[model samples]
Target: MDQYKLFLQRMGLIGTSTFLVTITGIMLLPILTQNLSIQDYGVWTQFQITITIIPAIAILGLPYTMVRFLSASKSRTEIQEAFYSILFTVIFASIMGAVALYILVVPISHVLFNGNVGVGLILPLTVIMSALQLVFVDYFRASNQMTKYAVFTTLQAYMVVIFALLLVLMGRGVVGAVTGILITQTLISLIMFTFVLKQIGFKIPRFHNLRQYLTFGLPTIPSNASFWVLDASDRYIIGIVLGITSVSYYSAGYTISSLLTILTSPIYTVLLPILSQFYAERKIRETRFLLNYAIKLYLIVAVPAVIGLSILARPLLYILSTPTLANQGYLITPILATGGLFFGLYCIITQIIVMERKTKITGNIWAISAILNIILDVTFGYFLGIIGIAIITLLLYLTAFLITVYYSLNYIRCDFYVKFAKKTIYAAFFMALSLILLNPYGPVNIVLSGLFSFALYIFVLWLLKGIKTDEIKFFTGMIKESLVNVYCALRGL
Candidate 1:
C-alpha cells in the first residue's frame, strides 16, 4: 500500500502537470491556426526548436543530472549545492549563447528562414526565458513540490497563448506572436526565480562545488544532443530540404505528437528522483517492480488514448485547425500518437539508465537511433512525405525501446521483466489488432467498435490469464481516481 501511494503520487503529480500544459497548448491551438499562415507557423516552430535545442547545449544537460542527485542525496545542503552549481553553470552558458546568437541570429535566420532575421532575435530571448523556466522547474521538483511546478508550467503556457491571441487580434502578425511568447516567458522566469530563492531559503548561492554539477551533467551532453537530433533533426532537414509549407506540415505533425510527451514527460521528472533514490539504496527489486508496473499501467491507459485520437483524427483536425491544416493535421495525429508511445517508453528507460549510472549506454543508444532516424527520414520522407517521417520515427523508436528494454533487463536480471514484457506484448498486440478491426467504420461506428474492442481486450486478457483479478481492481481504482481529478478540473476546483 505504501509503495502504491508513492507510485500514485509520483505519477499523479507529474502527469497532472503535463496534462495541464497540454490542455493549455491545445486550447490555444485553434487561435494560432486561424491567425498564422502555414509558413508563419513553420517559422514559429523553427524558433521553438532553436530555443529548446539551445538549452540542451547551454545547460549542458544539468537539469537531468540534477534530478538524479536530488533524488539520491539525503543532505539538504548537498541538494542546495547541486542546485546552485547547476544554476551558475546555466547562467554563464546562457550569457555566452546569447552573445553568439546576437552575432549570428541574423545570418542563421536568413539561411534557414529565407532572410527572416527578426526570428533570430526572438529565438535567443526565448532561449534565455525558457532556460530560466527549466531551472526553476527543476528547483521545485528537487524541493518535492509538484503543485508549484504544475502551476508555473501551466501559467507560462497559458500566458503565452493569451498574449499570442491578443497580439494576433490586434494585428501583431507573426512577429507579434513571437513577442507574446517572449513576454510571457520573461514574466514567468521572474516569478520562478523569486519563488526558488524563497523555497531553498538562500538569499544567494553558497555552493563552491561547480565541479559537482559539471562532472555529473557533462556526460549527459551526448545523450541530450542525440535526443534532440532524434526528435528535431527531421525538422531541421525539412527546413533545409523541403520548403516552409512542408516544414509547416511536418511541424504540425510534430506538434500533435508533442502533446503525448508533454503529458508523459513529468513522469520522467518525478520518476528520476524517486528511482535514483531507490537505486542509491540498492533497492533493485523495487526499481524493477516499479518499472514493470509502470509499463503495464501506461499501456492500459495509453492504448485507448492513441487509438481514440487516431479514430477521431478527421473531426479533431477539422475542429482544431483551419482549412489549410484540417487535412494535414488529421493525417498526422495517429502517427504522432504511435511515435508518442515509443517515446514514452524511451523516457522511462532512460530514467532507468540514469538511475543505474549508465550514462554512456543512454548516450550511445540515442546517438545511434538519431542517426538511423535521420537516414530513414531523408530516404523515406523524400518519397512518402510527412507520413514517411512518421513511419521512420515510429520504427526507429520501437527499435530503440526494445534495445533499452533488453539492456535494462540484462543490467539486472529480474523475473518481473519477463512477466511484464509478456503482459505488455499481450495487451499491446491485443489493442493494436483491436484498432485495426475497428478501422473500417465511420467515426461514430469506429468509436463503438473501439468500445467493443476494449471489452474484447479485457475479456480476452482474462480468458488467457494475462492479468489477475486484483490487478483489474487496482486499475479500476486508478481510473476512478483519474476521473475524480477530471471532475475537479471541470468544476474549476
Candidate 2:
C-alpha cells in the first residue's frame, strides 16, 4: 500500500484505540471522585502526575530515540541490538530512578501526595513498571506495528481502569488505586516483553549504536521533563499554595479539558515514525506534505473541538464529576482547551524540527517555556489560584507554539492553513452560538445538543466550501477501507 493509505489506516486504528482509552479514563473520573474523599482524590491525582513525570525521566527519552533511529531499520539484527541496548539501559535507569524516588518519598509525600506515606511508598514500583512499559510500547511504534501498538495500548488502559475500579470499589481508596495501576503496568509490560522476545529473540546487545541513540535521546529527557513541567507542574503548585482540595478541583477541570488532546494522540503516535521513515528515504515532498496535511487535519477537528469543549465544559464536568467540582473547575476547561489547541499545533509543527534532527532546539524551546511556566505558575497560582495558573498555561503553550513555528520554518516551510483555519473558526463560532441558544442542560440534553452542534458545524463548514468534495470522498474511502480491514481481521480470527 502507499504510505498515505497506510498512514490513514494506522491513524484510524490508533485513533479508535485512543478514543476508547480516553472514554474509559473519563468513566473512571466519577468513580474515583465519588468513592474517595476530596483529599484522597487529590492524592490520586498527584500519584498520576508523579508517575507521568517519573517515567518520562526514567525511560531516558529512549522511546523517542527508538522511534527516530529504528523506524527505518530493515535489518533484524540491527533492530535487535538497538532495541535490547535501549531496553537494558532503560531498566538500569528505571532502577536508579525508583531508588531515588524511594529516597525522596518523604518530601514528595508531603508536597504532592498531601503527606500520604502509603501512596508515596508504592510510587517507585509503579514508576519502574511504567518506565519498562514505555520502552515496550515504543518498540511496536517504531516498528510500525500499529495493530499491536493499538491493541496493547487499549488493553493497558482498560486493564488499569478495571483494576483500579475494582480495588477502589473494594474500599481500598487511593493506595489501592495506585496498587491496581502498578499491577496493570507490570502485567502489560511482561506480556509485551514476551511478544517482543518471541519476535526478535533475545540478545545481549553489543551496544554498538548506544552512544548515538543516547545522543539523540538524552536531549529529549530535558525536553520531556520540561513538557511535564508545562503540562503538570501547575498541579504541584496548586497542591502546595492552594491545598490538595484545590488540586483536586484543578485536576478535575484539567482532565476534562485534556479530552481535547485525544484528537492529537493518533497523529502524534503515527506521524513521527512515518515522517522519520520518509525523511530517512529523502522523500522530502512526501515528508512536507504529510506535515502540512497533518496540521490541516488536526485544526479542522481541533478548532471546532476547542470551541465545543469550552462551551460544554460546565455541563460535561457536572455530569462527569460532582457539582462542587463542576462549579469550581468548569472555567478551567476553556483556558486549558485553548492551551491544548496550541499545544497540539506545537506537536504537529515540531515534526519538521524532528525531521531535521534538531532536537536540541526543540528541547531548548521547551526548557525556556517550562522555566517561565514554573515562575508564572508560582506567581499566578499563589496570587490568583488555579484560574491564574490556567491562564498562564495557555500563554506558555501559545509561546511554545509560536517559537516552534518560527524555528521549524527554517528547516521546511509548511502551510499554516490560515484560510482553512478561518473557515473552521467560523463554523466553530456558529456551533458555539447554536449551543448557547439551545442552552443544553442535564446529561440527555447535553448529549443531544452536542450532536446537533457538531452536525451544524459540519453543515456550515460544508456550505463555506471549507470541506471539499474530494476531501470528503477521501475520508469516506479511508473509513470504508478501515472497516473492510477490520472485517477481514475478525474473519481471520
Candidate 3:
C-alpha cells in the first residue's frame, strides 16, 4: 500500500508537470497560425517531423537499452559505465547523422520544400540537439529522478514557445522558428549533460558491454523508425500531394489529437522501470496486476477524452486555430483522437514484449504496419485528400494495436476488463449525446457544455457501476490529503 501511494505521488508530479507543458503547447497553436504564413507553418511542421524522427531513429535506440540495463546494473561502477558508454555511442551517432543530413540537404529539401535549402541546413543541429536531449531525459527516468525530469520536460516546452514565437514574430519564418528550437535545445542539452556527469561522476566511456547494449537497442531502431513513419509520414504525403496549406491544416488537427498522449506518456515513464523490475524478479502476478490496473486507469480517462474531443472538435479547433482551420480541420480531430487511443493502448500492452526482451518482434510488427500505413496514406491521400489521410491513420493505429496485443498475449496474458470497458462506453455514449444536444459554440458555451458533460459522464458512470466505490475512495483520499496540505501551508504549518 505504501509503495502504491508512492507510485501515485510520483505519477501525479510527472503528470501534472507534463499537463502544464501540454497546455502551453496547445496555447501556442493558435498563435503560430495567426502569425506565420500557412506555407511557413507547413515548413515548421515538417522540420518538427524531422527532429522527431531523427532523435528516435538516429540514437540507435541506446536510450531504451540504457533504461533496460541501467535498471538492473549491480554496482555503481557498472551504472556509470553503462550510462557513459551509451551516451558516447549516441553522441557519435548524432554527429554522423548531422554530417549525413548536411551533405544530402539538397535532395531532401527538394522532396519536402520544393528545393528550399535554408531549412535543410538547420537539420544537422536540430538532429544532434534532439538526440542529446532525448538521452538525458531518458537518463533522468532511468535514475528515478522525477523532479529533474519534470523540470527539463517542462522547460523544453517553454523554451520552444518563447524562442520560436519570438523569432517567427520577427519574420524569420520557418528558418527562424527552426533556429529558435535548435538554439534552445542545444543550451538545455549542455546543461543537462553537465548535471548527468556530476550525478554519475563522469568516467571516460568505454566499450564495456557495448555489444550487449547494442543487441538490446539496435533491433528497436526499425521499430522506432516505423512508429515514426506511422505517426509523421502522413504530413509528408499531404505536402507532396495536396500542398503546404493542406499540410498545415492536417497537422493542426493532428496536434490537437496528440494531446491525448498527455495522459498516457507520464504513466508510461513510470510503468516501464517498475514493470521491468517486476518481470526481472519473475513476479508474474504483480506484473499482470499492474498491467490490468494501468489499462483500466488509462481507459478511464482516455475513453472520455476521445468522445469529448470528437464531440467538441469544431469549437475546440476554433479556439486553437484560425477560422479557416477551425472550419476545415475540425473533422480530423476525432479520427486522430481515436487513433491516439489505440496507440496509447498499444504503448501499454507492448510492455510485455519489452519486459520479455522480445523487441525484435516489435520491430517486425511495426515494420509491416508502417508499410501498410504508408501505402494507405499515399493511396487514399492522393485520391481522397486530407480526410482520407486521417482515416488511414486511425486504421493503421488500430492495426498496430490488434497485432501487438495478440503477440503480447502470447508472451504474458492479462485480463483486459471487458466489463469495465463496456461501462465506460455506456457513460461515453451519454456524454456524447449531451454534447450533441448542447452543440456548443464560442468560449463560454464550450466551458459550460464541458462542465455539464463531465458531470453527466461521472453521474452516468457511477449509476452504471463503471466507477467502483473503492476507486472513488482512493481518489477522494488523495484529494483530501492534497487539500489538507494546502491548508497547512496557508496557515504556515
**TM agreement with the true structure for every prediction:** 0.87, 0.97, 0.94
Better of 1 and 2 by TM-score: 2
Q: Judged by TM-score, which candidate is best?
A: 2
Ranking by TM-score: 2, 3, 1
Determine which window of 10 residues in candidate 1 has minimal summed lDDT: 413-422
Model 1, stretches more than 4 Å misplaced? 203-208, 225-227, 414-493
Model 3, poorest ten-residue lDDT window? 484-493
lDDT of each: 0.71, 0.87, 0.82
Q: lDDT, candidate 2, residue 459?
A: 83
| Candidate 2 error regions (>4 Å) | 476-493
Model 3, C-alpha of 297: deviation from truth (Å): 0.3
Cα deviation of 487 in candidate 3 (Å)? 16
How does residue 346 of candidate 1 score in lDDT? Answer: 70
Candidate 3, pairs of clashing residues: none
> What is candidate 3's lDDT per residue for 72-107, written digit by digit as tens?
566888888888888888989999999999999999
Best lDDT among the predictions, by candidate number? 2
lDDT of 1 by residue, 27-92 (tens): 666777778877777777777677778878888778776776776566767767778778877878
